[model samples]
Target: MSSVRLLIGTRKGAFILTSDGTRKHWDVSGPQFAGWELYHLKGSPADPNRLYASQTSSWFGQVIQRSDDGGKTWNPPGTKPEDLMGPDGMPKGESNMFLYDTSAETGKPLTTHQHYDGTQRPWEFKRVWHLEPSMTDPDTVYAGVEDAALFRSTDGGKTWRELAGLRSAKGHLWQPGAGGMCLHTVMLDPGNSQRIFVAISAAGVFRTDDGGRTWRPVNRGLKSQYELPDPDADVGHCVHRIAMHPSRPNVLFMQKHWDVMRSDDGGESWHEVSGNLPTDFGFPIAVHAHQPETVYVVPIKSDSEHFPPDGKLRVYRSKTGGHEWEALTKGLPQRDCYVNVLRDAMAVDSLDPCGLYFGTTGGQVYASADGGDSWAPIVRDLPAVLSVEVQTLP
Candidate 1:
């Protein structure tokens, strides 16, 4: 029988939830790195026992850590967050260099970039927003950080180097969204290792055919009417989150600031498929494990109101990919529920019937073992869940 593991990152710390194939009773472990912000946690697809984490602090800065024994223990190749600085104020170690820049400055941006209205703003490394382990390399992982930059760590989070070439994709014009300019989504093409896609707030989506060496903006069809002088501009859309089916790498689904979009040509272009959704403004999106045509999204009221529409918590499912959607509300709260789901908070596991899971800001982690036909909470209280990822074990 297969087993399952749920790696949950929360605002206060991290937790590991385990269950067998049946996924009925679960075993919960830890508030690891307690009192710290566990922005993201992900396991290597090539070696499930190997895991990586991004831990951030308001006073200590950011540090990357790794675990070799399936969450039993963790100690990445980097220095401790509290130890990033030395007693004499000199640079201490490798993790201090921060993302692509690699400068000695540990916390803030040194240079400035063009903002949305063509204003200059310093890039901020607030935290690592997402961690994507290479599907085939256990030691190779990708980290997407705030203020929008991509970094790769091939030595199991021991060291990181920024993919400086990403700047060629008109990065100067990229601006921060309400949550800061974060390269929050990094989707690897299952069929093409050399091709990579990344999404940035206020900068739209960019794709690279030659790994991370070169990138080009693929936002030709993305339209952002708000916060831009030209809604038709090619590089200022605030893409909330993007999802790609493992079998169909070229096909993409997006939960934009206000519209649900689909890209049939590998993000070369896009078209809105909001269809019958109550409100298109929301975060987080996922593709079903076996059905590429099926997708999921949680509909929030609007960008201004970051809660479910009509005070109801509902997960919308689309069997036809985009234009068509139905609310999955069997075990969900339908009244006065206003919890918001973040971009990295929803995921699907590749089980026989497949399974769907998501975490909400109200400290609730819900699961659906038989797809989205029904729902149940694995845990009702945790520190405002930040991100959720699932792994299926043999």
Candidate 2:
């Protein structure tokens, strides 16, 4: 029988949950790095045992950690991931290994981007918000970082080079949202290796057709009346999260800061599908594993308050893509529940019936063995859940 592994990254540390196909009982492991901020953990589709993690701290900065035997072990790739700045000359002379710097690559200072207050600020490196392992190569991976920049490590996580071309696509226009202008979503197209899509908070989504060499803003038909002077600006839309099925890469679903959207022609354009939803204000959005038309989202009260609407924790499902939605509350809290779900905190597994999983700000991780029809909690208490990734093991 096939089993699944859940890689849970939280505000404090990381945990791994393993379960057989039934997904009823689970074997939970670790607060892995103890006190580190594990922003994201992703397993390589090409190699199930190979995993990558983003470990960060305000005082120590960001470090890329890797594990070859799944989550059993971890190590920073090129250098000692400590905050020691000395002439000892670290592996890459980077006292903080992952700081956003273009001196080595471009011999220029970091590009400045538009700030929320209409001021320009130099891009800064804070943390890796997401890690995307290549669909075909276990040794290749991509990292999306704060102050918004993209990097790729072909030699596993040992050495990384910035794919600075991403900046050419309206980098100066990109502004930080409430989430700090981080590139939080990295989607790799399985059909065309050259095509990759990424979403940045408040900066909208960008696509690269010729790999990482160049990119273009694909935010047409997306309106942000209160956020931008032009309701349909090419950039500067606060896109919370975007999801799509591997089988249908062109079809896309998005959870915006205030609306749920859909795109049938990739990211070339998008349209609002927030119909029938109590409130389209939410963070995470996901698609069913087997049914491309089935979509899920958790609607919050509003941006000011991140909790669910009416204090009822419900996962809304749209069987006909968008516009039409149904609330799934079989075993959920229907009242006095104020938990919010983050963009990277939801995921789905490739199983017979399709298992859906999501983590909450209240430290609750819920799971549904049969799509979004019903749900149960895998674990109730933990650090604030940051991300949840599922891998189907053979």
Candidate 3:
């Protein structure tokens, strides 16, 4: 029988949950790097057993760990890659490296951010918000980081080098959102290896046509009153998350700071699909693995108050893409449930009668074995849940 593994990343550590196809009783194993923040954990699609995790800390900075036998064991890549740069352009002289092009087109070092005091601060590598493994190669993976840059690890997460073109494309226009300019969502087009989509909070959406070499802002129709002075500005919209079904790669769905949107023409343009959703101010948007038109979003009350509407935990599903929605609340709490779901907390597995999974800030991970008809908590009472990824094992 086939089985499933839920790779859960939390504020404190990482956990692994396993179950058979039934997905009823589960075996939970972890708190893996106890006391460290595991921002994201994802398995390579080409090799299910190979996994990568983004581990970070205030004192230790960032570390990338890999596991070959699922989550049973983990180790830093055997070779030590040099550090790219410190918080500033100065060298930290540490190992486990990140390499970004030092010299800019103008013969000056890259300037990534501006501080509150109006000082120009060089881009600092904070943490990896998302990790995307190549669909065809297990050893190739991509990392999206804070201070807004993209890095790739070709040796199975052992080493990384920034795709510096993304920083050069519109680096000056990119400003930090309240969340500090993190690239939280990375999507790969399975049909076109050259196409990639990424969402950065307070920076809108960007797409690369020729892989990661060059990128352009794709916020044509997005309107943000809170962050952008001009409603139709080139960039500077707070896009919470974006999702796409593998079968229909061009069609995209977005969960913005205040609205749910859809892009039909490969993100060259977009339109609001908020529909009848009570409040589209939520994080995390996902698509059913088998049903391309079916989508899911968890609607929170507002940006200031990151809780479900009316204290009701509901997973809104749209069977016709968007413009219409139905609430799924069979087993969820209806009152006093103020937990918020992070942008990377929701995921769907490619199983028959597809399974949906999401983690909450309240330290609970919920699962719906039969899509969103009904649901149950797989585990509860850990650190705040940051991300949830699922792998189907043959």
For TM-score, the strongest prediction is 2
lDDT of 3 by residue, 190-291 (tens): 999999998887778999999888788899999987656788888878899999999889999999999999999889999999999999899999999999
CA displacement after TM-score superposition, residue 47 of candidate 3 (Å):
0.5
Residue 192 alpha-carbon offset, candidate 1, angstroms: 0.9
Q: What local distance difference test score does each model get?
A: 0.87, 0.89, 0.87
> Which residue pairs does candidate 2 place in steric collision?
none
Steric clash pairs (candidate 3): none
- lDDT agreement of model 3 with the native: 0.87
Candidate 2 matches the true fold with a TM-score of 0.94
Alpha carbon deviation, residue 304, candidate 3 (Å): 0.6
TM-score of 1: 0.93
Put down candidate 2 lDDT per residue, 62-159, tens digits, no spaces: 77788889889887765545533445654453312454546645414447899877888888778899999999999899998887888888877876
Model 3, residue 363: C-alpha shift (Å): 0.4
**Residue 194, candidate 2: C-alpha displacement in angstroms:** 0.5
| Candidate ordering by TM-score (highest first) | 2, 3, 1
User: Model 3 clash tally?
Assistant: 0
> Residue-pair clashes per candidate, as listed?
1, 0, 0
lDDT of 1 by residue, 308-378 (tens): 98888999999999999999998888999989999999989999788999999998999999889899999
| Best model per lDDT | 2
